[model samples]
Target: LLGDVKAAGTEVREEYRWTQERWDEYRRLAEEMEEAEPSAKGLIFLDYGKQTLTSDGRILNEYRFAGKVLTQDTKWWGTRAWYIDEGINRIDVLYARSISPDGTVHEYSPDDITFSEPTRGEVFFGQGTAMSLTIPAVDIGSIVEYGYIDEEYAPEDPELFQPRFFFQSGEPAKLSKCEFEVPAGRELFYETFLLDANDPYIGQTIKELPKFVGTPEPVITRTDSSTIYTWELRDVEPLIWESNSMGYTTIAPSVHAGLYPDYSYYHERFGRLHREHIKITPEIDSLARAIVGDLESEKEKIAEIYHWVQRNIRYISVKGALASRFGGHYAQITLDNKYGDCSDKAILFSALLEVVGIRSYPIIVMTNDAGFMDRSRFPFWGGNHAINEVWWDGERHVLDATGNLHRFPTYSMGDCDLYYANYVRGEIVYNPPIPAENNSMQSVTLVELRADGSAIISDSMWFTGDMEAGYRGYFEYMPEQRHEMIVEQFVSQRKAGGRLSDFALANIRDISKPFLMEFSYEVDDYTIEAGNYLLLEVPALRYSFPEIELSDPNFGKKSDMTFMRTHDVTFTLADNYTVRFVPERFELSNEYFDYVANYEVDGNTIRFTDRYRVKKLRIPISDYAEYKADAEKIMAYVKERIFLSEE
Candidate 1:
């Protein structure tokens, strides 16, 4: 489709010439990485590749990697796919080629590249675009290299231009570098981070000012017209992946460059950009009052308004809406369309709360899963997502109405326990972490075993925090036809011939309370019956425990992390058969996690109770071995079964 459009990247005004010395260096690096990571598919000769920012607010990005494919699975690396935001930039494929083991070179044609919309998951609208091509005759042991450039012509705010370079990735690199050329009279602030995954001090005090994380050591070159700054790293190994580890962005060595003076610049600039659009019109006021309907407590009013926007406003991305990559659309326009994205929802919710006499400000968040956003690092556009912060009764509460599942004071786990930047508050503030008890799941199951090894079961499960948000969000967005099938599928998942009856859900749309699921189940054979004995265990609960595995070799070497998983279960049995044995109480407690399960039996009844809670968020490597061993015991305890001998 881009046949006639002018290509900016492929012309190759100046491209790197492959010399014998460069080729020899690549061979030596390839041999080193292949021996160290024999199981890896490929190794990069150059990563963080070629990046240059000109003085006129235009940026150039090019990656030239002479990487050897160790396996057939990665031969597709020769199939080029370049992501672009065509709305503001033009791209050119300067060069692409593949060199086989026997030194056969297959050069790719830049003219062969074509343009199409990028494949983002279910996102129907955006400035996202892509360029593609297929290099000929690439195979295992082939070294493929490619380069491209994208130039942004129109930047809404040139002063807010901040470019960050991440030097480390999952693929090991021989060398990675970023360079910038700026004109005289303009000074750019630069900070380089060198976070070590194995450093106990860095991991334990990541949120606090980390000592070894940041250093502005850029190589500077001066000329009469301009100055250049460069940052480089060599012999960089790939980051190791560990189970339950924090995001790689936390440990990745990176350099951030920005012209903005301080963090307040972001707060002031963003607030002013969207301030004109966040007006509370008569329509918004009427809607807000109607939604609250004389709710007296400020907290109640906040919940009513937050939940209203979540259910009423549809979430759909639009090009140029937040594509300027900051702020939101008008609150009135969002209410008129009955739909908006995350930023739009936050804006509308903020306006509605304002109408109800509650003080609120829109804020930006970098979400827990995205990466670590250190204030010590020069402040740029740190958050990838936007929400709102409210001040009520001398307390600060950060809330998100982007999804319908979360209740007041509880939000998506991603938005929980992170630092955020708000326009009103020029200083960065911390949103205190929600206690593990708030994000919990409680379940109850009653089983009655018949003489023929069949059982009738009644089940009810309750959810709060993220647990409530996930299931409720699914039901809210899921198709109506699939709802019944989803409920029925739970029965068969537990037992082969099981059927569900009297299934009911609570608070699916009401975000004021914990989400609840209640159902009755009947299974043909819940146990194996011998001549005089029945072998049975607790019925499989719908939600199982978090799969905690420390099998990865890098577990202790990588950053330690703890997930919030609090679960409580109670199982009651109604039967006349004499119980021969009851499993003893099993408890494992440590700084990492807490687990306990015990059983009680009386006359013709048996009660089994289980509770598990995560005690810490960051588990140091020193404590991991003990945590791993205890975790294994809990895994075994849950699967343990008691033999029943009938009278």
Candidate 2:
């Protein structure tokens, strides 16, 4: 079957043989593919066989193809694959050519001195059909072809061959369905976009360029059913009502029954796995002993173990076959054998912690690649990653080991917004975080215009706990470059009147703390003008506010929706400037808690301060109207311009 397919195309010919030697060679290749799980299209593995092969599907002269002697004897097996081409070429191919009882075909184009013609042989197994080839190697040439194949080894579906590209998530969505409670005036809107049926990539496709994942469209929209897409709309009330700070709302009985893949399916799969693998692991035994031996410190011990597992095991992505084969649940395997996927590591770590008397469960997280996971919808393959949930001392904390960061148990700001599936009180609920905001920094810069055309600049900044972690991690990855980049951006804010020649930085206070970055800068000729009196303008501090415009017609006369971030900065200028202007203050005032902004001056120095401390975790969208009013006022103040006037 494999050999005959190679012969049909003018580009190459296929041949096969059924001799004992040939059988042994192919058997090894088949086993290699099964072991690596490269069945997911475009996954490339390299050959570690006795013989070395180049990435361009080239075999060294000393290798054998179809039992025909080349330059040397073929020693070992190497079956790595990537989706280099679509159609018949994309299938598994052992070397380039095969010879059995069918016919002979070209497998590889070698850069040989002789340019020898491909030898003819008989086909043994597959003949006349384009054989699938799996070449295990890194570097799938940056771009590859993608297409669909049928179960019968025939080109069953739409035969359009297209170029496929890789996309990673950009910024993660900060809000999901789990964040809010039903209020009398506010309606909850939910939208989910499915991938195009024909898209080569799985999961949502509305991603920023270059990266596959990022913030979902703030405004939910639609796309083709087969291609990755989003579901979003105007203020549609919730199908089921929720109140208080409850974990989740139950889908109606009718909805549950009609929903695809009922909770019962997950329950059974998880239950069986727990009975078989989890119940017998040493992790369980150790945990049981810990609980009984020392009741006093069991809580701390369990927390420590949970943290340890997350730190030691890094997340390697194994999306396609692993999920399909494992029934889309979490389980642990050896790090060496485990392949470092999100669920595999989470399951292992959770079970390990469980053995040590810690209560942990698998967490299903929709990666940045997929839009938010709405519990209202039933999906089999929406989310692409899994984490672990630990409920200790009545508090739930999420753990992500597969992230691209280090020394972090919790996810970053955007990552924290993913939905998870957990057995809560014997029921599976799609869980999102209670908070609908992200951690970030707010940096305010103040520029002092001088008569000499130079300026004295100062900056103040604050960070959230998670933002600090990310900042520090980034610095660790590239200390000099990251630090300089940050410093440069700050200085750029000091736009001078002319092409400033000299640039200087000073008073860079240490930012080792977990939630704040404080520093100031002094530069010369920072954008000064030479017309009578000097003109000075102070740049507003960098805030975490979303970039919004109210002009879009798709949305009704509603203020743009924004989320929370971990920052607040204000700039104050002394009234001594010839041109006097000041920004107005704004506030988010509710009876419970408010984030207010105000400015004050004391003698030579001006003072600006911003306060952001939301009292409640969840804020209903009905409250957005009031919040938007406050935010608009504050932003207006910040956008106010200051200029220098000469007498």
Candidate 3:
């Protein structure tokens, strides 16, 4: 085929630019190969990138580890297969350490295959870069299993993982190149499928490998003419289930088990060094003074600094291998360079705030990577983000410097709180924004019907600290895309029973000082059939706790838990209305607890009121079940109460 193509086409033809008809033929052949055989078990291959031994030989071997599995009975392979080209010029050293349920480490050789050899062999077309990865297995696990594949990827390598042969990098690839063998007694059902790659170079590609019964099997194939350095893999499932997936899960509505910092020597050193060397210069002082002039409120001053950094800095995600080198140090250089990741922006904001009278702490937050932050282990190697915590007027405010356009009133709390394990490092650690200080508030829909068959309703909300920070992140950072996302989210949640006729945001206001967000939207043309009325439930609308509780079954009682969120809403009925379901006013009255809910009606407007406070800093997991149940109960009450009537 290579000779035929070369002879048929002009020698001047570009590399990889095959004719359309020829490309289609190649794809067809690849498809046939893909539909090969059934390999029963799962196989993971490790090809750790190259390593150079130093003169002193200071353990460079331990430095280039790739992929961390969080499950049991995981089998991996390598052998000479780790060599990319088999020419001996480019080779990878593979090593693996599996952890037992009891935390015992077992090292394995490359030749071992504990389970059935599911997918094996690489197809070299006698020449070139085109290739494919195949996985053949049987239906055995749940769809929700957490599977992740992180290969040794470095962008500096020119030929590193470029998209070819119908694969688009970064996007989801749908390839059916393998067959699933159904065991005699086992059932077959696949609920969900997911493919993800953080690197942008490799195009996402998916080809279906047909499943045929008996001896005929499937294969994954690819043909590339270019010889480039990169890493690629096809993962079909997670190493462990979500329940056992380690790290921080959610952040906004304050959860107890946020991501804990890993207790590694490097982490401890980074924490200590960060805490020690975090500093601001006098030049920042002059700059801040010039900008603020005479802002009286500490909040305003802090907000100005936050806005300045966010506005001045641009977001550039340092991904892949370079992140490890670019992440630490160079905060000021990033500021000077005017481009940085989230942490760099945060550092600049903290520095600027320090220049003024307002004190700020440089906090580390866990992004999706590195799992959750473990507070119990204070110095856990946790978190992949850097944010700021500003203290003002006896209260601490969370500041995210990434989105400068969203300073003050427009705060963002979206996924920022999902797995927030934050700590104040350096001289500014006086009172960093703790999980306890976060709060979210939202009003529920209290729709009352009138005699004329029209409905009346109202809504209100408030947020503080981390919740405000989240809102700020969303409102300010992503102004262009915010309203659209908000509309979609609202429509999806509220328009469950009735078809969404329309939604419109009204009464827009920016109250940055107290950091409050207020907006109203109308859901029009909503109808409930007689005897089967419409019930619009209020989503748990806090940054964290209002939606779900941070408690566990093993831990019976709630922690020194903090409750913080407040809301108000009114619904105006059309006419001749009557109350159908009215929630009972409830209050939890323990020093450690802070909560209240009530409803009232005046004229045509029905008002729903709520309040919450935080008194404790930490909540134990032992009491999570009760807390979760209580939260559900409250949510049910709020959802159940709906004013109904007929014309």
Q: Give all candidates' CA lDDT scores.
A: 0.69, 0.37, 0.40
Q: Give the runs in model 1 whose Cα sits over 4 Å from its true position.
A: 1-40, 48-51, 83-87, 120-123, 195-216, 321-324, 376-378, 475-484, 507-514, 528-535, 541-548, 555-576, 615-622
C-alpha TM-score for every candidate: 0.87, 0.50, 0.50
lDDT of 3 at 301: 84
Question: Model 3: per-residue lDDT, tens digit, 262-290?
Answer: 33433444445444334565665577787
User: Which parts of model 3 have CA positions greater than 4 angstroms off?
Assistant: 1-57, 60-91, 94-285, 317-332, 357-383, 388-400, 403-438, 444-449, 456-567, 572-575, 589-595, 601-605, 611-621, 642-647
Model 2, range 49-155, lDDT digits (tens) per residue?
11111223222211122222111112111222222212323222223433322222223322201112233233111112222343122122111111112212222
Ranking by lDDT: 1, 3, 2
Worst 10 residues of 1 by lDDT: 205-214
Which 10 residues in a row give candidate 2 its minimum summed lDDT? 249-258
Highest-TM-score candidate:
1
